[model samples]
Target: SASETPGKAAVGEENIVKLQHVQDTREFFIEVLEYLPGGNLYQYLEQKEMLDEYTACRVSLRILKALDHLHARRLLHRDVRLQQFILAEPGDPESCKLADLWCLASLPRKKNFMVEEGRPCDLLTAAPEVVKQGEFSAKSDVWAAGCVIFELLHGHPPFGGTGKALVQRICCGEPEFSELGTATGGLSDNAIDLLRWMLQREPGQRPSVHECLKHAWFEGYNVEKPSKQVWQVEKLIRHVKLWGKPPHSRRNLPASNLLASKRGIVTPGFCTYMGATSVDIDFEPCQMCQGVLEVIGKSEEQQSLGSRVWYWVTKCVLSLWGREENPKQIQLKVCVKPGSPWVELGSCTLDDSTALEASIKIDKPIRYVRISLRGNLGGHFGIAVRKVAFYGYQVRQIPIALHLENLKFLRGSRLHTHAQDIHPKEVNARVHKSLQSSLRVGRRIEGTGAKYRVYEDICSGSPHITTAAETPRLKFPQGVVLIGAVLGLRYVSEVPSKESAPPRLRIQIVKEVNAGGDHERRMKKTLLFATEDLTPPSWKANEVLGNGYVDYPVMFSTGIRANGDDRLHLEILFQNFSGTAHVPADLGLSFFYVPELQSPSTSEDEGLWAGCIQSVQSATVESVSLGMRKLLSIWFPFHFPRSFPCDFLLLRFYILQPYILVSLT
Candidate 1:
């Protein structure tokens, strides 16, 4: 029968099982086919769990050929999965044959092909269109094949869930490909690109079986194992072992571009490594990017995607002491996440003679790393680590200070120098008018209505004509936390325009509370600093206002949360002292949005999130401004909660060499 089939020569016959004999009986018809001793690929995967990049590529290449053969005859193997493929030989994995063809269907002449409603099939391998609109075509088979290939590498299907939610995700979701393998069994961009093409939601956009075969993922790809596998961390570290004498000095180091090479352990700065008994290294939270799944419903029990999963460590470089009489063995272990088991990353020998630089290439990504030293007795040297580096998937955080021009408060008209023209009564009247207009148009401002009007006019054109300066805005990838800030300023005694006036600095915290639809309320807290400190008898007038630094304590008992629905704003105003503490004329004003603060779920989570054992640190310092003369710098340290969805936070702005630094501990 195989010999009689037409176009059998064109389509590789070896990829398919040969139909041998058939018998006809009165009650039933029996057929016989070639037998292969090896079991199906699904069984092989069950035994091996997962395949390396080379083996996976080899198996995928043959599966594509089998699919190509079937598609050439305009036939659809509706069920395309690992279970449908049988291995031709026991030991050889690449020798796969397409077996079950009972679900095969001929290609329809119509452009649109629809399957029966509620038909039971492989849900995991089913395409989006098939699950949504019941549309089935040859491209649907390609989608199924891609899923098989994905499972082969990652050891699981691209999408996981059950019931209606799984169906919804299949219909409207993209696969998570943050984890994929390359030619060396590491992350491969080419593989991800190919998968994107094969798994396109629109069937027409997907490449044909032939086009998939021609993709660059298959180029220069062979079944032969790599001469030196880069994914084997043990093999990479084993080569640097030397039982003899050390080199002259610590001159021969590994490549400088490694993860921990020049960059310090916590951040990109200098680090001093001391020889200690035991040491644990964790990456800085600010260096990583994070994402959370969109909550589908407001209910507490509603299921939504959690924060993104990360296994940042892939390759590592360790610089250790090279020469010693009794060398100590180091044990390397990695933890995938908190509470997860620590996997052994293999041990290596180290000495204190010459500088030893060992590059360990890991096949898997790890989150936390723990290193222990063995063979160290009382009075013997412990693990002497010079520098350690890592290489893997990283989403760097944006420095808030570097992009200060983008802040909302920094963008607007120049400082208002004509404070002398408007009387206090006239200013109050204008403030009242602006407040009435904002209420009518559904705008909310905490204090100083005129300043709010100016900000509103610049951001969104309003009827109120106000001057606002233009400054750059920092675009965040996702919602970020505001931890803290620091400010620096220069004060002057008397203003050039106003003869007897003295300058003052005012800081305000404004929180906008939203009560459901339409209705909203504003809460304000203000702190003022004056430069009326008595000058020393020997000091001159100019010397008193020349240079000074003051520490201002900002205390709030309750937490503040800022989000799209509700917001918290920090505003700073420079004004001339009006003799009394009641009112001060505004000279210039600037404000920006601060991060939302939420309480932790548990006490243990609070400790982890706070990054310190102390619950609170408090210090009181009196505020004294040297009469603002142009210099202004801010540095605020905002508290970041570990349980929150924020990946990184930044506080940055500049004015006349003034800069703000936001530090997260």
Candidate 2:
């Protein structure tokens, strides 16, 4: 430690080395303190790669003690980095000791004064508030310690960037362990939990030296005795494989981690709850891939955070879209803030017949967004934007209808109904006639759209993704289009008897006559379900009904078509009767739908406009009457004049004559 004042160099002047003429001209003093063995932990880590969490915790505890000693004496080591900690050597764990108090202060100095004094606080390990507000306290030391811990556990600092960029990132970003799981093997809940606390951006949230020692990470360690803690550190390091080990073969699976986020380059926050350790992840490639900025529609759900909203997303132009017979209805919602009750921002009909695609914009800022659409895709949700722009802190372009996994950000996809977890099993029950034939393992069947938590293949039941996701939407002349699929199935009934067979469910959507006419008949032409096989059984839900019975939730997805006429809807049906088993009890199917189908001639009205009109919203004017399978039509004449004050094209559907109803979108 050295300072302009000899006393500050070596308190009490016992080890102060007067190395120059001391006068107003200027002088330097070097402190000759006690000599101890051991280089800093930073250097040790360079050679060893990483330390076991237990050892890291012990080291952390020792460092905490050092801070406790300094803070107890009203001192603050503004810079507590790995390089500043001296190690007596790996064998002598207790030999670890703190170094460099040149920048130490009895109390926090003013921001202006600290700058003038040339404080040596390490910017990378600097407390966020210190970086943003030029402040430091006991908590600042904790933040520095957290940085050291992060390096010990992950081999690098939590944030990356150089100079000003580095400084800004540290001030705004949350610490993340991108190398969580397979790399660290798995971190101790206590270790990660404590690390999060230490790296808090708010200094007040950091724990005290006393609290650090009391952390769960030091559970089996003896903190009362310094020697005991050292012994425990070594003991824990010897056996620390914090989480379960990943099979060597499975280690090569893609790092199913986040690709980008304002939080960190890759946020591994999802690993803890997602059971992502053993699964392969293919993150959606962003504009970062094409090198062209895109307004991305992520398939993964994003956690709501206050990352400065960057775009208002005013316009979204979709192409290769679906629904050939009629215009598709699309709805978009955005969450301005986090949590419940999303706001519906836009809802419009997409029809390519008139060469006008689906595009809308809102001149406002939004935090989170979602889209629920029903259209006809040749088994895909084909959609790409010629242009997608949003205005926010800054206007930017992004992607539309993207699917991403991991704890990145939120973007919903029609392929996101989400499948419930499943495990494979063998049974001898007699399935209904629909599935009386042998079921194949590799074949796929069409059903409903669903989101999935990728893991090993169900056929092999290992830690690797077996089947690649089917292409829901490719490219279309109209706009991007994709059929939806089923995500999960929860059957609410008693398990079929051992001799009873589980019914096989094959799903598909088709055109139906008016409800009042031929209401009980099944249609033949499939619109959504276009496949023959089904999702092979993966996991079973047996926790509910005990014994030999195990229920399961099957995941599925399919194509879509507009259910134009209210009476003419789609019906989900299947055959049954293996030993006379009851139907799936309350058989219910969840599928996507688009409203109103317009013929080419009927849609032409959208293009007709009055010579001078203020605005033209979608207006449909028509009148039809139906009763007992009988249909009657009547055409109404319009008074087309400048003074015809109305926005919509009126439509009057007289179902069974007099029951009148009005509706608009």
What would the TM-scores of all predictions be? Answer: 0.36, 0.33
Q: What is the C-alpha lDDT of each candidate?
A: 0.43, 0.37
Score candidate 1 by TM-score against the native: 0.36
- lDDT by residue for model 1 (49-133), tens: 5566667777888888988887778777777888888888995678888876545566666553547557667877889888876
Which segments of candidate 2 are over 4 A away from where they belong? 1-26, 90-94, 108-118, 181-185, 221-665
Model 2, 351-439: lDDT tens digits are 55333355555433233444434443222212222211222112111111111111011111111110122212321232222121112
Number of the top TM-score candidate: 1
Model 1, C-alpha of 82: deviation from truth (Å): 0.9
